[model samples]
Target chain A: MQPGISKKRRAYILLMRILMWLSVALTAGLVLFLVTYVMAKGLPEISWNLLTTKPSYLSGNIGILPDILNTVYIIIAALIFVIPLGAGAAVYLNEYARNKKLVAVIEYAAETLSGIPSIIYGLVGMLFFCSFLDMQTSLLAGALTLVIMNLPTVLRTTQESLKTVPQSYREGAFGLGAGKWRVIRTVVLPGCVDGIITGCILSVGRILGESAALLFTAGFAHAVHGFFEGLNSAGATLTVALYVYAKEQGEFGVAFAIAAILMVLTLLIQLAAMLVGRYFKKRRDL
Target chain B: MCLPMKKRQSKIDPVTGGSDIRPPVLWDSLMKKQAFENFIYGVFLLLGLITVGCVLLITVYLIISGIPAIREIGLFKFLFGKTWASTAKTPQFGILPFILTSIYGTAGAIALGVPIGFLTAVYLAKAAPPKVKAVVSAAVSVLAGIPSVVYGLVGMLVLVPGIRSIFHVPDGASLLAAIVVLAVMILPSIVNVSITALEAVPQEYEDASLALGATPTETYFRVSVPAARSGIAAAVVLGVGRAIGEAMAVMMVSGNVANMPSLFQSVRFLTTAVASEMSYSSGLQRQALFSIALVLYLFILLINAALNFFLKRSKEA
Candidate 1:
């Protein structure tokens, strides 16, 4: 085999090998640089006071408590509404819908929804939810926009896990005189818990990272309030806050702190997704 | 209902409790259950349509708001005209600069990003050890998960300044800076999708090539890569969509100026053009912002259609 190789061919192979290794190194290097650079610059800026207080013009100091709370409120609000709609759509696709054409149309729509960028979502959200619907630039409008954006993720995941539920189990339930709703409620829905949870994690990660979509729908206000009050008022999530701070206010310290927090959250979400995947795999194997 | 059920029960007598109460009771409950099931089914069916309804709403909203500006500005002048001074005394609404900048910037990102990402995918899919692959893939996922704002922050504070000094430019924020940020941002999609496509190539293809006295590297590239070209193309299309649609990251570094795009000149993209002006714009300017969004949306729709085409072809192949 070695003797059969010509010098030109060997040189080409060597070049490719070198190129392959170099590209991989560059990819890895970029990731490393980003993670370490953000963390190194940001972690020191985070403080107990910074996380727990609000910005006061009198004090001429800034804090992100309101932004943090708004993030939590929007995430919760979006999930509360989205899970039911998303899971219901999945159930319809998996258990109820008999029309293949209808299912295909819905799936295609979901794909389109996912492909449309967040900026477009912001524009439409501002138009329909904020202006047309008279919701104004409030967190509620932002949450509704996110529900539409994440609906596909939730539906796809639930549909995947629903397929894994054995058909024999469904038949057995039917044989025992269980109605269609009963069969889904007792057998199919439980089987999809893992997917729904995974979807929630992914949505949370997206919600945390999102800024452009919320910029118009959720105006950048730093008001701390209860969940219902928060939803009615305009506010900024961490990502939006980071953008405003960095771009407009020139507050690099606060921006970096938020970046670090987001990075850590991203890491945690990745870990949780992997762990959930492994756990489900082991249970299925068993 | 109770009276009828009692009469039916009495008709069968108390001889067999199970058999006596079965017919009317069963019929009644079955009808009720069927109605309930139908109700729930309709509810869920409605739920499924909600996603479709949302897509329609977005499309309709964009068109309705987007048309006025174009109608006023003239489509040719709006899209092809070379000036975009929304606040000038006479105000020109031409968006050629934003359009060209978006196109050139996306092209630049693809040019710089795809080769490295493709090579990396090949290495991860075929050449790297299992342990190394695992670590690198995790890193890639982290890159994907980082918020766009963070990328902008890093680019603003680091890459822009670096470019300004290295290239001897007056301003750090330029189209070149935006391109570099976009190239980094799109790396994850290209690498991940290409790796998947490469890994999906059947083992037997490589096995046969190896048995034919071809080197492993040769077999991997010539056989495996050709087999996965459709998937790689789909990945590239996906990256193009991402690069073109990005707003926040590009907005932060591209300087928000509506200049004709040059490598080191400050420029605005289609996405940034909409985002930066929406807050304060009024009258025709406001409608024109909507029109800009419409343009960006149309670009995204084209990218999405191309992505779907590539993906469908890949699946078929």
Candidate 2:
């Protein structure tokens, strides 16, 4: 609007804004671009044999079936512990407690817990939880360790969702002479179903993608048979596999294939969570 | 029959707008009421105890189990040493160089990520059309949900080679490449927190600022930012915590070498140092790795403490 605010100055301001946004877009693009380029280069090396077969000493062209199996096993096992434990904790925090001091402490604990570096969790997983349980890098120990790593996140998300339910609904239920348990089950739980699902989906992303705690407790095994045996066994995950392949794989082709697999898996997870969440929300609306 | 009826009548009368009543002997007993109340109270106490117990046990566990390596390495040398060869004859555990590398890398990332994240958050919160805001926010969240390992994979493939060619570096996996990737990795946390903070600024403040002859942008920088400074500060610290604590993505493209960080050179960070050598390490060397991990954890803890302190100060102010 001013006379001195000429074309050059306006142009400079516009350019700066564009550059600022370009960086954000570029930052987000870095991973996708990398994965696409490498996977395109190396997908040929990936085969059914590479996926289904076990590792071999003689050649670099081995399979990751066991590692993949281990990753799934630990994640499922982790969810088992995380869901019940974390959801229960969230329930307690949201439904029962009335004291502000107690609530503050729980909130502080969550922030601090999330801040602790994962490597320390790995060490503790190795030292106490795994050793004491006699689980030794087995799915049981890995799951237990990850349960600790994930509980805070799971609890926080669940608690936020649970809190979103209307208090009036709760009061109405109570006025009907329903017991406390019945009120929570019939009114509160049903109302927050979507939020809970969102939390669980987000948490699954964490458990599947995590590497540090698994580093010590879920020592890589590549067996896909007999659920217990495979679970108890140690091997690799998509993450650990990518790490191992990138560092130790003699051929760039193999390494790139593994990296591509990780990228696709992660993108699928993000997409699935969003789509599933939206689908459920749309259904509820209808 | 007559006595039972009379007792029931008395109990009902006392509870429902009746005179103080006497119940029959068995019905009037105090034991049942005490037991029920005690059980209810006990359940509440147990839940409280569990929360307290968990926080206490984990903190104590981290400190007790994670300190031995620090003890062995000695403070100055472990923190300030340059060599990080876990398999070497002497097995030097000087993680100082790695620590500094982490610092610089984290610094670079925060510098690039925070501003854009803040502005984008503000746009999403205050400026953008609602539909566009929703899409952008979801995109940001998707970026957040994408695993760190996946980010690492991308860096290794696209960013590395792209940087190598663009900057004319020998390797694509250099400090600059790592910085760009990490900046992306941190965007979600920064944006999400900052948006919440910006949205928290009361609308009336903006209206009032506009009445004083300030432009929208001026009001935003001076009024909104300062008013939400505490939240922004908390957001920044939280990002730092994530950046420093992050391991998988940094390890993938940081070139995992223990040396001073040159902008174009490959460097290892404290996180990458532990992760790369962890699978093969043993003895004092492994302990030293644990020490480095402890240092990383300590840095994060310090950030958290600072966040709480700043939040308190801001609240008081």
Residue B154's lDDT in candidate 2? 65
Please name the candidate that would achieve the greatest DockQ relative to the true structure: 1
Model 1 per-residue lDDT tens digits across residues A79-115? 9999999999999888877679999889889988888
lDDT measured at residue A64 in model 1 versus the true structure, 0 to 100: 98
Q: After the best TM-score superposition of candidate 2, give how far the Cα of residue B217 lies from its true spot, in angstroms.
A: 3.8
After superposition on all CA atoms, what RMSD does each candidate show versus the true structure?
4.8, 5.6
Tell me the deviation in Å of residue B72 in model 1.
0.9
TM-score of chain B of 2: 0.85
After TM-score superposition, what is the CA distance of residue B266 in candidate 2 from its true location, in Å? 3.6
| Candidate 1 interface RMSD, angstroms, 1 decimal | 4.2
Q: Write the per-residue lDDT of candidate 1 for residues B1-317, one digit (tens) a residue.
A: 11123356556543345464557776677657756776777898899899999989999999999999999999999999899999999999999999999999999999999999999999999989999999999999999999999999999999899999999999989999999999999999999999989998989999999999889899889999999999999999999999999999999998889999999989999999989998898999999999999998888888888888888888887
Candidate 2 docking class = acceptable
User: Which parts of model 2 are misplaced by more than 4 Å?
Assistant: A1-16, A19-61, A172-178, A250-265, A275-286, B1-55, B162-172, B211-215, B309-317
